[model samples]
Target: MLTVDNLVKSYGGAGRGRRGGGPSEPEPDTRAVAPDGSRVFAVGGVSFTVEDGELFTLLGPSGCGKTTTLRSVAGLERPDGGTIALSERVLFDSARGINIPANRRELGMVFQSYAIWPHMTVAKNVSFPLDILPSSRRPPRDEIDRRVRRMLEVTELGAYTDRSATKLSGGQQQRLALARALVIQPEVMLLDEPLSNLDAKLRESMRFELKRLQTELGLTAIYVTHDQSEALVMSSRIAVMNEGRVEQIGTPDEIYGRPATRFVAEFIGTSNFVRGTVASVRGDTVAVDTPDGRLVCSGAGAAPAVGAEVLLSIRPEAVSLARDPHPGAVNQWAGEVLNRAFMGDAVDHVVRVGAQEIRIRSHPTESVEPGTRVHLSADPARVTLVPA
Candidate 1:
């Protein structure tokens, strides 16, 4: 297992540099500043762990510190604080002063760019790491060749062994990159948006392929990406990061279905948020009073105290719409359909409920005409409550 604890990285020295992502872009909220406005923290005390044979993803948007965290784990970037360890080995420790060199850390990394050596053959690319190893640690020539062949087979690139690395298709080159990383048989693999370079269709297909390779090889990997769908589809567990901190960590279903925070509910996918105050708590059910009406959450993980302010997150698909109210529905309200969008397989309708507008997603065939009166209802189990 690989563990990172309270890792911190700052740029331009503490208390001596300007803030923000420069003039080209807005400063990320995660780019924390010291109280005196001295230090610009890129990764502000980020932490997570990847179990053996599991692919844990650091998922967030640009400048959110996901890449920096991955780079720190690969020893490509030095952190200002915190501890990094691989199983029983101490890879880095600020307090103990035990920073391992990147090359000696025995971690494999695949970057956004495939970084394939254009002149080398597929086999050469895969074997280069072993070939350049220190003589004392290098495997015998036959052993190196065997490992290279085995990785190629595992990555489904055995037929491309003799092909020039640059001649392979984008997908094939991606496989070659994975083959090269796997050749080392490193303790952990760090992938930094490895699929971001491919076209959309290829990228989608490769997600499954990469997951297959990771599972079949029983590889421990930490994948970093800004794509929510990618993380949801490929990760064994996901750490949703924003502004340099982990917002929530859980299986894809939990993160998507029951987000721990408003940021998580908004970032993972689309969620309609309703600001409300907790009205009551009974057993597993917690009722909240919103501007529209009372919303009850039945699958609430931990109920907040009564009368506390909170945000109710209802997924677009979770809100059911009908021309007439379902008799005795738990959480139902009358509203006017403001507009709708046909999204191929699904349709999205925007309903104006008093002072608020709630979006509902439904089957394409269920599209409601604009300006029509509709009843918006949600199951108690589908509504999630987030602390305000």
Candidate 2:
């Protein structure tokens, strides 16, 4: 397993910058350095683990520190403080004064740009890493050739072995990059938005392709991306980052269905939020009084104390719309359809109830007309109670 504990990387101001700090320097305990200036923490106390053969993802928007954390692990960027280890081997430790060189870390990296050598053949591109190794560490020519061929075959690029790297298409080039990285047989792989450069359709397809390769090879990888669907589709578990901190870490289903915070719910996907105060707590069930009405939530993680202010998150797909009210429904509200939008396979309707507007998604053919009266009902189990 790969472990990172209390990793911190900052820049500007302070005693010494990220790379300037040494074992002799006294590190500041907090982000603030002096009365005259402060530091920008690209990664502030971020921690997570990547199990063997698992595709762990660092997901967030730009400048959220996801990439910095990945780079810290890759040894491309040095951290201010923390311990990074792979199994029993310590790659970096601020206290121990151990910082492994990037190349010596034995980790494969695929960046946003494939960085294929246009002048080299596909096979040469994969074999270049081995060919440049010091004579003491370099494998024999026959072994190098075998490894390169094996990687090409595994990446489905054996037929293009002798072809120039520039001759391949976008997807082929991506596979070539993977083949090159896999040829080294590194201890772990670090992918930093490798699919972001591809077009939408290609990017979607590559997610599955990368996941399949990682599974088949039993590769332990840390993938960084801002795309929610890509993380949900390809990761075994995801760590959601925001403002240089990890907000939550869980499986895709857990992150999507049971967001730990409002930012997670809003970032992961579309959600309708209702601000309210907890009215009652009954075991795992809770009642919240909102502007729209009283809502009951069930099967959530834990119940908050009564009278506490909270926010309720309900997914658009979790809500059901009807022309007539269904009697005995647990959480039902009568409203008028304010607008409707066709979203290809699904249609979204904005309904106004009193002073609140709720968005509900349904089948494209089930769209309701504008200004039509409708009823919105949601399963108590689908309504999530988030701490305000």
Candidate 3:
């Protein structure tokens, strides 16, 4: 397992910085070191663990510090404080004064740019890392050749072994990059937006391809991306980051189905957010009063007491429109369809109820016309209450 404890990396004012820190490396405890000047923290204190053969992902928007955290683990950016370890080996320990350089970390990295060498053929590009190792550490020539060939075959680049790196298509080039990285047989792989360069369709295709490759090789990897869909599709578990901090970490389904925070609910996928005040708490269910009506939600993580303010989050797909709801449904509101769209696989409808506009998605065959009166009902099980 790979573990990170309280990792922190910051910049600006009152410190010698990553590489230039004097005798005693400074801890990243100064929140406002700049005083009058501005301080920027690319990565605030964050921690997580990657289990054996698991594909872990750091997911967030631009400037959220996801990439910074990944770089810290890769040893490309020295952290101000924290301990990073792979199994029993300590890669870095702030108190111990141990900081492994990037090259010595024995990690394979694929950046947004594949960085393929145009001059070298696919096979040569993959073999380059092993070929350049110091004589003492380098494998025999025949062994190096075997490793390169094996990687090329595993990455499905064997047919293009002698082909110039520049001659391949976007997808092929991506595979070539992976082949090169895998050739070194690093213990862990760090991928930073490795598929962002491809077009949308291609990017989606590569997500599956990468997931397959990671699973087949039983490789432990840390993937970083801003695309929520990509993270949901590829990662075994995801860490959602915002403003240099991790908001939540869980499997893709858990994060989407039960968001721990409002930001997570809003970030993971589209949902209709209804602000309400808790009216009652019965067992695991919570009833919140809104302008539209009283909403009773089950499966809400914690049952808040009556009169507490909260936000009701219900996914569009969980809500449905009907001419009339079954009698005495827990959540049912009368509304008029304001807009409708037929989205090949599903139909989307925006319904206006009292002062709230609720969006509902259902099967493509079930759509109501605009301005038509309708009823919106959501399963109590599907409604989640977020602390307001």
Candidate 4:
């Protein structure tokens, strides 16, 4: 298990002046400075706990501090505050003045670039970490060779064991990097956008392979990425970050279906935002008035008060469009198809309803041409009402 408590880091300090400033010392918290001279918090007070053998992911947009948090855990960057612990061992504690060296932390890391040594063969690259072991504790030469071969075979790189890392393709290099990391047998693996370098198809395949390896080895893994689909497909739980803070943390389904905040609802997936004022609240549902019409939505956490301004977040897949209206639906809107886009297995339609535009997704087989009048309806329980 890994636990992080109130981690914080700032770059510039009194010794480093602003770009055009004179010899005078810069502000104490210059790293946090904004264009207007206000302090910018790269990482605010962030805390989370990951279970043993859990595949936890930190997901967010670029500059959301996901990478900063990962570096802090790896000990490459010292946080100005907070504590980090792995399996009850205190690796970092600002108050206690304890900061373990990165090499002594016993954690493996794989980067987006793979970071393989071009000068070394696959076997040498995987065996390099073992060189740090004390002479008295180091394994025999044959044992080391056997273990390296096993790791290479597990990662499907045995055939290239003697090949220089630079000769491998992007995907092969990525697998080699993983093999090298696993060779050390660390308790936790930190992956920093490891699949970002691969093509779309390869990225998808690697996600499954990485998940399978993590499960098979019962290794605790912390993956960091800005790609929402990657996070959704691989992580047991995702911590969504924004502006140096964790916005929400939950399983993929929970985060997608029941986002805790407006930021999360918009960040995790495509959502049609309908601005309106709450007309009424009934049980878990809330009635809101939009430019198109009144809509009954399933409020995420709590029902908004009547007349309060809110936004209805409706997923494209949750909406259904028909040439004729459906009976008994709590909400329906008549619209003209503005545009249609064909996705491989699905079709997306942009419908213009009065002054608002709503997106709907359907099977590719179901065709709705532009200029056609359509009736759009959704399950009331699928409409999510969030604060505007």
Clashes in model 3: which pairs? Answer: none
Q: Which model scores highest in lDDT?
A: 2
Clash pairs for candidate 2 = none
CA displacement after TM-score superposition, residue 120 of candidate 4 (Å):
1.6
The better-scoring model by TM-score among 1 and 2 is: 2
Question: Candidate 3 has what TM-score?
Answer: 0.94
What is the TM-score of each predicted model, taking all chains together? 0.93, 0.94, 0.94, 0.90
lDDT of 4 by residue, 1-388 (tens): 8998777765553332122111121222233454654444557767888998899999999987899999999999898777899977999998898999998898999988888888999899999877668888678888788889988988889898889889998888998999888887888899999999899999999999999889988889999999999999999999998877787788999889877668898899888888999888878878889877899877445787888998888899999999998898788999999999999999999999998789999989877999999999988878887667
lDDT of 4 at 96: 92
Badly placed stretches (over 4 Å) of model 2 are: 13-37
What is the overall TM-score of model 1 with all chains considered together? 0.93
**What is the Å distance of residue 127 in model 2 from its true position?**
0.5
Model 2 C-alpha lDDT per residue in residues 1-388, reported as the tens digit of each score: 9998878888876543332222222333353344555677777677788999999999999988899999999999988888899999999998888999998999999989999998999999999999999999999999999999899988999999899999998999999999899999988999999998899999889899999999999999999999999999999999998877788899999999999889999999999999999998988999999887899999866688889999999999999999999899989999999999998999999999889889999999998999999998999989998879
lDDT of 1 by residue, 1-388 (tens): 9988878788765544322332222333333455566776767777677899999999998988889889998999988778899999999998888999999999999989989999999999999999999899999999999999899998888988898898899999899998999899999999989999999999999999999998998999999999999999999999988776778889999999999888899999999889999999998899999887888999787788988999999999999999998898899989999999999999999999999899999998998999999998999999998878
lDDT of each: 0.88, 0.89, 0.86, 0.84
| Residue 320 displacement in candidate 2 (angstroms) | 0.3
Residue 348 C-alpha lDDT in model 1: 93
At residue 248, what lDDT does model 3 achieve?
85
Ranking by lDDT: 2, 1, 3, 4
**Candidate 3 residue-wise lDDT, 178-256, digit = tens:** 8888888988999999999999999889999999999999999999999999999999999998777788889999889
